[model samples]
Target: MQGVDTVLNVLGSVCLLLWGVRMVRTGLTRAFGATLRRAISACARNRFTAFAGGVGLTGILQSSTATALLLASFASRGLIPLSIALAVMLGANVGTTLTAQVLSFNLGWVSPFMIAVGVIAFLSNSSDKARHLGRVAIGLGLMLLSLHLLEAAAAPLRASPAFVAVLSGLQDEYVLAVVFAAAATWFVHSSLSSVLLVMSFASSGIIEPKLGLALIIGANIGGAIAPYFDQSTTDVDARRVPLGNLITRVVIGAGLLCFLGPIHHWLAFIDPAPARLLVNFHTAFSLVAAIVFLPLNDPLAALCRRLVPSRPQADDPGRPRHLDPNVLDTPAEALACAMRETLNLGDKVADMLRQTMDALENNDARAVKAIEAADDAVDHLYEAIKLYLVQTSRNELGEEDGRRYVEILTFTTNLEHVGDIIDKNLMELATKKIKNRYSFSAEGTAELRAFHARVLENLRLALNVFTTRDITLARRLVAEKTSMREAEMHAGDSHFARLREGRPESIETSSIHMDVIRDLKRINGHLTTVAYPILEAAGELAETRLKPSDQTLMRAPAGS
Candidate 1:
């Protein structure tokens, strides 16, 4: 009966420890979210920078899984290369050791204070960022307190005959200890949690220092397995980082086991205290592994490529798409990919619009036919992106990502609208030419072609802004729209002037010229609709263009 009670108590303490660690990690991620993004971006540019970024972020978040997952997300999106990702993963292993250091200290009394402050901040009407920070502090405090409880629970087991016997058996059989440690880490889904438990046993004298060190090493290796498996279905490039992480740990673990004697001797010199000695050894092992593996990142990446060779039709459009539903687990990253696809849709639509316009002006029925077919392709892309966004919204997303999703949906919808407008409006004009037997004069055709060129330029610029989110390009779009409006006004005035000059042949041509000018102006208006939303989403839209002129320069040609 006493043994059952002890088991239950240990289970409860472990649960609290896991919960506390989750809370702390979540809070820290929320508090420094922007900085984390910036760090990721900065690290992507260079291998060394990426390693530093991974270490710093994992140190702040206190979770290697989170860092590993983030790296996978970046690689899947093509934001960072596989070599840099491997470096980052190596650094993350070192960073996760910080949690063990924190748990080793006697800080149980600080738990209540952390809870109080965190709860108050969480419940307060303060900024969301502040509340997030408070939650992190509280979680850290609780984790420390749980460690204290775990130590106390194990303290009783230390003097028990059965418990001592179990510990002695684990110590003598290194293989059993390694297996036990791996199972504990896998079961808890956190290396830090497993390490804390092992550290508690060590501090209470339930396990020898050597066995504890071995278990800690095994836990690190085990914890890495989950992330690697999780990343298996991601991009081929992304799989390399987790694969490298797994290999590094396995190699290091094997080396440590073979040289267990020297490892213990080296630890004794650093710290004679058993618990501290174990912690120091754990830290040292990770740091050394990071340094040793850092230089081999490129070769590791190459090996992963050879092992998980890219398929023959990997980049083929018809190949089974690689966009996994699991990616939606990270909403921000999912939205970014969605946006990229949306931009692709925009480009297709723009091309269709240009081709349709050319077909109309040049009287090429085949181009009109091509435009109609392209519209169907745009429809397909729209459906895919819309479905993706719907799935993304179901996940827990950050505020920025949520808004970006909304913006992308809006932009895609507007692009679709532009496609519809081009196909329908230009087709109507084509019908007019066939039905009324109306053929523009040479002068009218020339003017219409000039107007078509201007409108197509605007469409291209709008698509560019969506693709790159280039503020400079967005501003240029606004400027072009302004210039287009002025050109339309000048053309209208000039046509009126020519009408009164007593040239009867000029009358029919002038009306067609005016129609072409109006259509061009209206196309630019829709293009602006696409541009402004992207600029606004980027928070780069100028204040002057916030409330864009509702008075479009093109009216509906006075009801046909």
Candidate 2:
């Protein structure tokens, strides 16, 4: 029963460690994720800078896997070269080792103090950034506390005969130790936790330093596994970063195993303490990896490219290009992707609008069919953006991100409505006009085409508003609503004037002309809604068009 209790306590400590790491990671990601991404991207001009950036970022983030996943998303989108991404991964590996080195020290005294301070700060702060920082503090405290608890949990097991026997067996088999550590790290999805556990065992005299070193190597290899699989995509470029990272770790790790005996002997001379020896070896191995592999990023990337050849892109226009699923955890990047896909959706709708004039005036059957096909494409993209945004919202989001999320969803919904207007309403009018052999007067035709062109222009403007959120551009887009209405009214009056002149073409096509004008105006209305969110956000929009005094009802003046 004691043995079982000890084992359970050990497992519990490990779980706590994992949870602490998670809180820290999520806190940093939520707070400074966009800045970190931009920092990484800005360093893409050179490999060495990119390497440094990755090291610094992962040191702060405390998760190389997170760094790897972020770089993979960028690589997949062709924002950075595959070679540069590989360099970052090498640096990220070193960064994790740096974290382990810090945690290896006996800062157990600081754990409780940090926890108390963190709790106070988190609960008292209303600022989002302050709260996020507090969350980071709490996570760090928990991590340190978990380490102390883990050491205590392992103390009871050190005296157990069965535990000693298991340690003895592992000590005899270097390969088995590596494999065991690797599997354990992979299962937990955190190499830091695995390394800390190994450190605890070494510190407790439950495992020798040589065995601990082997286990660290395994942990290194295991660290790259989760990110590689998590970045699974049809694009080979995206897969290359993680795969290159894995290959580098495996090859370098296996090669180092042959020298493990000599390395352990050399480390013992510097400091014979088991825990320090393991921690130093882990740090040394990572630094050596970065030194050896940083220069070879280009060659390694080329090798991976050959291993995972790029597949041909799918022919479907409806398939989303920018909505990378891997970035959903990072809401800023995910929202950026959603924004781009929304623009893509807007482009499809614009194409449909552009084709409407040809169908309406020239009676072009092919143009009508193309517009219909374009609407179908718009629908597909709209659905894809909507679903992707839904997934993004599942992650914790800041106020700005939340607002942008709504803007994207609202804009896409409006674009979808615009497509429906083109497909169902305008196309139906075009079909009827063609079948009935209706032709508008010369003036009426010019006015209809001019109005169509103006609406198309507004569609482009709405997309610009969505993309930039420029107040000036948004205000212009909203103002066009009035111009469009007046144009519709003017066209109506002109049609009647032509009717009074007894123009045969106007009389024949009068219903279709009026319907066409109304449908174009309706499409314009949909496009115009994209501006309202932006204006309202800036407090430039009034609640209603009526004056404040207009709210009061006037009594009938002594009604007769």
Candidate 3:
């Protein structure tokens, strides 16, 4: 019964530690995701900068796995080259060791104060950003407290014969010890947490220093494998990144295994305490990896590419390409996938609109036919996006993530409306114009073409606003809509004036010209709807674009 109690207590402490680590990673990610993404991307132009970027970002995020995914996402999207992404992963490995170093310190005295301050801040903060920071602090405090509990749990076990025998068995089969550590890491889904657990055990003499070192190596190698398997079905570019990073870890792990005796002896001489020795060795190995592997990024990337060659996109419309069902477990990642699909839908709408404009400008029947086909594709994509989002909506989502999901849905819906106008309304108008051999007057044609150009430009802007959620860009898009409306109205008056002059071409095409202009204007209206959701969310919108409908406001005073 006593043995069972010890096992339960140790398990509880480890679980607590893992939970604390998760809370910290998530809280930090939510608080600084945008800034970190921007910073990492900005520094991805060259190998050196990319390496530095990875180090800085992972240090702040405290999770190499998080940084790895970010690199993979960027590479998959063509935002960064594969080589630079590999370099970033190398640096990220080093950055993660910083947390292990911090955890190994004797900071039990600070845990209570951290918990108190974190709780107060978490309870007091009303703003979302502040609330996120508070959560980070709380997570940190819990982690420290968990370490304290871990120490207590292990201390009693150090005097147990059964515990000594287990250690003896593990020490005899270091390979088994490494496998056990790897399994534990995969379970926690965090290498840093796993290494810290090993460090705690080492400090209490529950595990030999050499065994602890083996476990840390296993933890690092296991961390790399987790991502590789997670991205098995992702794009070649994404999978390549984790594959490259995993190769680096495995290579280093193998080389370290050959020299483990010398390395352990060297580190032991420096640190008398088992906990400090384990953490120090982890940090040292990571530094060596960064130093040794940074120079080989390009070659490693090439190897990764060869290993996971990019294949042609599968011909499956029913399958959602960007919407990975597995990522729905993580709301932020799920939102990102949905957003990409939304942008893809926007691209289809843009294509249809482009063809519709060309069909009108050059009077091409084939372009009109193409617009119909493209619209069908757009509708199919919209259906896929809607269905995929529905599946992910069942998952638990944070407030901000839920809002982002709705924004994607709204954006995709507007794109569908735009596509409908181009295919159904404008396509029909183009067909009639071509069948009747009607041509606009010179001035009317130029005015219509210029207006069409501006509308196309605004569609591009709307898509950008959706992707960036940039309030400034969103405002510009809204403002451009007003300009587009004015242009539509002016083009109409210009057409009417040409008709009044009885120009032969204008008179022959009067109905087609007016109808085409109206259709394009309606398309503009749908595009403008994209900006309203963004502005309203920012509290920069009014109740209505007109005066209040209240009866009291309409009534004149009796004195007047």
Question: Which one wins on TM-score?
Answer: 2
- Ranking, TM-score, top scorer first: 2, 3, 1
lDDT of each: 0.76, 0.88, 0.81
Give the range where candidate 3 is weakest over 10 consecutive residues by summed lDDT.
317-326
Q: Model 3: what TM-score?
A: 0.69
lDDT score for residue 283 of model 2: 80
- What's the TM-score of each model vs. the native? 0.65, 0.86, 0.69
Clashes of each: 0, 0, 0
Candidate 2 lDDT, 200-301, residue by residue in tens: 999998888888889999998888887887767446777889899999889889989999989988999988889889988888878888888888888998
Best by lDDT: 2
Candidate 2, superposed: residue stretches over 4 Å from native: 1-8, 38-50, 155-173, 205-210, 314-316, 319-337, 431-444, 467-476, 489-512, 537-542, 545-552, 555-560
lDDT digits (tens) for residues 1-560 of candidate 3: 87777888888988888777777777777667667878988888888888888888888778888788877777787888999999888888888888778878988888788778777887897765676777778778888988889888878788789888888888867677777877777767789888888888888878887888888889998888788877787789889998998898878877886777888889979987898988898888787888888888888988988999878875753345687553544567778888988888887787777777678867899998888888888888889888888877875466887888888888888888888888888888888888887777778888778877778888898888888888899888888878877887788788878878889998888888888777777777777777787789889887877865668566867775
Consecutive 10-residue window with the lowest summed lDDT within model 1: 314-323
Q: Mind giving the per-residue lDDT tens digits that candidate 1 earns over 310-397?
A: 7654333211232345456446656777877876787787688668656656667788788877877777778888888898788556
Model 3 gets an lDDT of: 0.81
Residue 478 CA error for candidate 2 (Å)? 3.7
